[model samples]
Every structure is written in structure tokens, then in C-alpha cells.
Target: MEWVLLVIAGLCSGIIGALVGLGGGVILVPVIVYLGSVGLLDGITPQTVVGLSVIMMIFTGLSSTIAYMKKKTVDFKSGWIFFAGSAPGTILGAFVNRGLDLPSFQLYFGIMMVFLSLLLLIRKHLKPVHWFVKNGRKTTFEDGTGTYVYGYPIWFALLLTFGIGFSSGLFGIGGGSMLVPAMLLLFLFPPHVAVGTSMFMVFLSALVNSVTHISLGNVPWLYTIPVIPAAYIGAKIGAYLNHRLNSDSLVIVLQIVLLLLGVRSILDGIM
Candidate 1:
């Protein structure tokens, strides 16, 4: 039964993660923590939860990246550039995660979740920054929708992704909560390209972050046994759905879920 629940959670996480480029940790971490809190699972700590979540993200990112690559949506150059900053930040965040207790971790994670939810809620109304579009590197992408041009300053992108990576390593929520929106609202990236590129960066950053967690003995290998394959399969399904579905509705649904989860987590931390 416990394994079944874990598999279900992984599938949900992977689908949501791939659909929106959230890397699925946003869903998985809270589920694991909640299960542990209710005594359905054992030996759950902030470190271990984060560790397991990131490990699962490795598969989520890889599976989604492959699917996006087939559609030619991934911006490989930007992914690499973003990764340059994210790698070091991920290492640093893993170290910081070791210092947090469960209550503190929950509090911070809840706040982050709420912030990300609100960011997404407001993202559609926001416009791309003029300075970023005018002065930064420029590229064009063409699809059935039409031709779109977008770019970001290399230096700013590095700095932004570093913060995203730090958050990922700390919370195991994958940086896509922040990265995807930034690409859409601040950097002028097309929606599909933003999600695809974000997943690519997620894959690379998770690789670095997971290694750091493994070395710190934070990973619960047994817990990850069911999650990996489930997440991988779900990612493939999500990638397929991305092309067919109107993501605006999904984003609205996701916003509500995150907001509710964030409030619950915050209350849990306080109590």
C-alpha cells in the first residue's frame, strides 16, 4: 500500500513537472513529508525528503527533455548557460539543507511554494522586460503558432539561475517554478521553449544536486525505488499532453493546489 501511494505520487509529480517544467519536486516533497507526518512512512527528515525528491527529478527531467527534444523545442545553448550558474548554487544549497530542522524547512518551503504560486498567477498578465529583449542576445523560434524572437542578457540569466538552483537544492522543488515564469515574463521566451529549456536545465542541475545529497548521506535509496520509474513514465505522458492541452487551465489548477498545499504546510510548521 505504501509503495502504491509512492508510485501514485511519483506519477502525479512527473506529469505536473513535465507539463509546466516544475521538475515535479514541488508535488513530491510535500507528499512524502505529509505521509511521514501521518505515520504512513518512517525516517523522513528534511534532508532525506529533499534528497529523494531530487533523485526522482533526475528521471523527470531526463524523460521530459527527451520528449521536448523530439519536438525541437529545447534551447540547448540557453540551457547550458543557465546550468553554469545553477551548478554551483545547487552545491551550496545542498550544504545549507543540512542545517535546517523539519519545522524550519517546512516554513521556508511553504513560503516558497506560496510565492511561486502567486508568481504563476500573475505571470500571464506580465510583459517581457523591454531592456532584456532589446539589448540581450537574440534568437528566433518558429512553430505553427508563428515566428517568435526572444533573448536575455547572459550575465542576468546566470545570476537568476543561480538563485533558482539554490532553491532547488534547498527544497528539492526543481527550479522550474521560478525559471519558467522568468523566461516567459522577463526574458520573452515562447511558452513551449521556456518549458523545454527549463527541463533541460533541471536535468543538469538535479544531477549536480543529487550527487551532493548522496555524498551527505541524505538520500533514502529504498524510498526512491518506486518513484523513479513512475515519474519517468508520467513524464512521457505529460510531454505528450503538453502539445494537445491548453496549459492556461492547468496553470490555474496548479495555482490552487500549490496555494492550498502551501497554506497547509505553513500551518503544519507553526503547529
Candidate 2:
């Protein structure tokens, strides 16, 4: 029955993560932590929870990325560029995770999420010039449906991705929460492309982190194995839903999740 519950959690996490590009770890970690706290999930430490969540993220990210590719929503060019920085950061973050305290981590995570949520809410009031590129090498990304043109400061994005990668590695959150928002708000990427591209980048970063976790024996295979199939199916469904939603709807969905999760994490940390 516990296994069944985990499978359901995995299914929900996959669907939400794929739709927002936040990855399953955001949802899964909290569930795993709660179950472990209540002794429903035995022998599961925080490290184990993070490791297993990241492992599941591998499947979630890969499944959704593939679906996004089929829809031609992925922006491979930008994805790889950011990946160049994210890859190394992921490896380094995995190594650093051992040193952090759980409460401190949660507190900081909550603060970051809240800050980001406020930014999204007030984005319209802020000058677009402050958020978007004023002048740069314009790039055109062609998808199956149409073409998107945008300009971004390449150096800034690469540097920012390094920080995102480190956080992903440390927390096993797949970096999508940060990555998708950065792409959409700072890089001015189309909504669909941001979601698809975020998934692709997450797959790469999570793959690296998974290897690191597995090498360290942080992953609990027994706990992780049962949830994989459900997660995969959920991701496919999520990708389909992502395409159906318009930009405004997407932002609202992402904003609500961030706010709720953010408050939860903050309260958990304090209590």
C-alpha cells in the first residue's frame, strides 16, 4: 500500500513537473520527506530522498523532453548553451550536498521560491526593457509550428545557468524551477519553448547528478524502482497538457505551485 501511494505521488509529480518544467523532485522530495518523518518510509534519510527523487527525475525529464520534441517546442540551441555551464555545476553540487543542513536548505529554498513568485506576479508592471534584451545578436529558433526570434546576452545566461546547476545538484530539484523562469523572463523565450527547453536541460543535468548519487550509494533502489513507470506515463500526459495551455495560463500554473510549495517549505523549516 505504501508502494501504491508512492506510485501515485510519482504520477502526480511527473505530470506537474513536465507541465512547468520544474521536474518531479520539487513535489517528490516533500512527499518522501513527509513519509519518512512519519516512519511510513523506513530507512530513508534526506540524502536518500534527494538521491531517489533525482533518479526519478531522470525518467520524468527524459519522458517529457521527448514529448516536447515531438511537438517541436524544444529550443535545442539555447538548451545546449546553458547546459555547458549546468553540467559542471551539477557534478560539483552533488559533491557539496553532504555538507548542508536540511533545515537551512529548506529555509533558503523557500525564500528563493517566494522571491521568484513575486517577480512573476509583478512582471507586467516592470519595464519590459529591464527584463528583455535591448540589443544583442538576434537568434531565430524554428520549431515545427513556426519560428521564434529573440535576443539575449549569451554570457549572462551561461553564468546564471552555472548557479542554477549548482542548486539543482545540491537539492535534486532538476533546476527547472529556476531555468524555466530565467528563460521566459530574462531570455524572453516563448512560453512553449521555455518549458520544452527547460526539460531538455534538466534531463542532461539530472543524468549527471544521478550518476554521482548512484556512485555514492545515496539512491534507494527498492524505494525508487516502483515509481518509474507511473512517472513516465504522467510526463507524457503533462507534455500534452502543456501544449494545450496558452502563455498566461502557463504562468498562472507555475506561479501557484511556486507560492504553495514555497510557503510549505518555509513553514516546515521554521517548525
TM-score of 1: 0.99
What is the TM-score of candidate 2? Answer: 0.88
Q: What tens-digit string does per-residue lDDT give for candidate 2 at 1-271?
A: 8899899989988988898788867778767766876788887665787798888988998999999998888878888888888988888888887775667666766776687677667765653343346654456777576777765777887788899888888877788877776776667777788889899988888888899889988899998777788888888888988877654676676678778878887887788
Runs of candidate 2 with Cα error greater than 4 angstroms are 123-137, 142-147, 247-257
lDDT, residue 142, candidate 1: 99
Provide the TM-score for each candidate, comma-separated.
Answer: 0.99, 0.88
Tens-digit per-residue lDDT, 134-253, candidate 1: 889999999998999999999999999999999999999989989998998888899999999999999999999999999999999998999999999999998889999998899999
Each model's lDDT = 0.94, 0.80
Ten-residue stretch with the least lDDT total in model 1: 124-133
